[model samples]
Target chain A: MNHVTDLPLWVAWLVAAFLFIGAGLTLTGSFGLYRLSSFYDRIHAPTLGTSWGTAAIVLASIIYFSALQSRPVFHEILIGIFVTITTPVTFMLLGRAALYRDRSENNPEVPAMDLPKDILDKLKLADKTESVYLESGERE
Target chain B: MSATILLWAITFAQIMLAIAMVLALARMIKGPRAQDRVLGLDTLYVNSMLLILVFGIRTGNTLYFEVSLIIGILGFVATVALAKFLMRGEVIE
Candidate 1:
């Protein structure tokens, strides 16, 4: 509580700068999620927050705590590491799931799997319709 | 002056994060597809976690970090499960 006043001027400024940067990036990512037109396009937006936004804020926290407590306090790194490891796994799984769902439904907009002809034949997926991407000459 | 600046910055960051959470919620509610909803939910989770961390900093307490960490873990698991369910139409298959 009162630690805010106890913090040195330089530390306070540094923390404030990081707070603005992290919060701004997170807000930008969320806006992209709300505004993007397609699921595929939207998938890339959250990473801005998940990666650097979280990092900058966590860095600020580390600096704040270490400055106040007079010790190296980095337990926040646990959140950082856990998030870094898990976000890609979740997003990749979600992306693959979305792709599979779209492909199985024969959605014309999604690209066909780019596999070798022999592999496609062996998998019995060779008869799938060609993707209508550039053929339509207009992006969705 | 420094204390006032830090205090105001923390307040502003919290407000911004809360707004981000609301925007994510809007996407979740307005999604045109299941995957979009799931993605929005994921973004919501991240925003809330960041908000919690900021709260911890404001109060000078490390306990909120653990809570935020737990939230991240649970959110990741929930998202993965939902994605699995979407992919195969089943969660445990």
Candidate 2:
């Protein structure tokens, strides 16, 4: 009673293969999410799943459906595009939030913050010292 | 013959996705901090979206694809709002 029943054996096998590969990549990415230690590290892990992982699965879906229906189907592209654009934005915001929290807490893991006043004062003193040396050199 | 094989493969994939979902849920429940929990939630959303997609493949229906899309959008918005809240204590400020 199924439509795919009428499709050729090779076509069905190809669709299955694509689905498996996509699902495997997604599983690997999520597994990395569990295995990774820090938030930043974990952030990179999901990208694997979001980027190519979603692509493969969506491609598989498109191929399978189009072949089965004997027509082009592309609605899955919407999900693919949505995931691609949103993943980076979410990761960046999360990374920035983590950085802000760490800096506020004065966590030793991050580099020291550059203070504006300290740099400006150092620059002024350096300029004065340079001018004094230049005047002395001119006299000599 | 091929239909049977395809069914078996799809079932296998479904099982794998279910396990992945469980792992994400474990992370969500076992978080040591708020941000960890948020990260876990985000991961869970992605896993669930994929799960729905796999279901669509198995059932040979396009309807589940729409659901997956909705889930993706909602997950993105939810994670973004949570991340913003993490930066400042308020979602809107």
Candidate 3:
């Protein structure tokens, strides 16, 4: 903060804007997690923070430090990139885990593992319509 | 003019980030389900990391940046472990 006063007016404003943007996104995302009604829906909320939220903050840091020191500082980029890559992995794993648990419990609320037993049973070998609407995108 | 603006902006941003952490913590505590709690905890980790970065900007220090990086790593690992346990009832199976 000592060197902050030494910065050019425009640079200071720029740093401030980025920091506010980053922090705002993060706060809103967390808030969404709190207000969302369903667990599945809530999972998507944090991605906003992890992605652009992290980006904006690190951007501000990079700008402030580079301006103060008069040289580009690239270390902050590591945090940005790391968060981007790992966040999706965690979310995905968590989603799959949640799905697996729900499926195993035979929760009537969740989709069945094999396309609704009653519907599957009704379809006979003689029907032969679409096989499975998603079979590698190859048309008949 | 911009000097004071910069200071206030950083302060405001820090407060926002801190509020975010509190909201995440609330969700973590109020979670009706295990997965919900895990999601909240993950969000908490991320918000806290961002808060640290804002601190980095405030004090003009590289040390805070490094600390944020470490927190990011820890958050990811912790979430992954918790998710794995939730899926299979075991952290390392």
Best of the candidates, DockQ? 1
Per-candidate TM-score against the hidden true structure: 0.90, 0.86, 0.88
Kindly give the stretch of ten consecutive residues in candidate 3 chain A with the minimal lDDT sum.
A125-134
Residue ranges of candidate 3 with Cα displaced over 4 Å: A114-140
- Each model's lDDT: 0.91, 0.82, 0.88
Q: Please provide, for model 3 over B1-93, each residue's C-alpha lDDT reduced to its tens digit, 9 standing for 90 to 100.
A: 767989899899989999999999999999888989999999999998998888877777789988999999999999999999999889986
Runs in model 1 deviating more than 4 A are A121-140
DockQ-superior candidate, 2 or 3: 3
TM-score of chain B of each: 0.97, 0.96, 0.97
* Location of the lowest summed lDDT over 10 successive residues in candidate 1 chain A: A125-134
lDDT tens readout by residue for model 1, B1-93: 777988899999999999999999999999889999999999999999999999999999999998999899989999999999999888986
Error of 3 at A107 (Å): 2.2
Candidate 2 residue lDDT tens string, B1-92: 76786787778777877777777777778776677788888888988898899789878899999999999999999999999999999999
Candidate achieving the largest lDDT: 1
Candidate 3 residues A1-140, lDDT tens each?
45667788988888888988998999889999999998888999888899888999888888888888999988999999999999989999999888888888887777777677677765653256555643533664
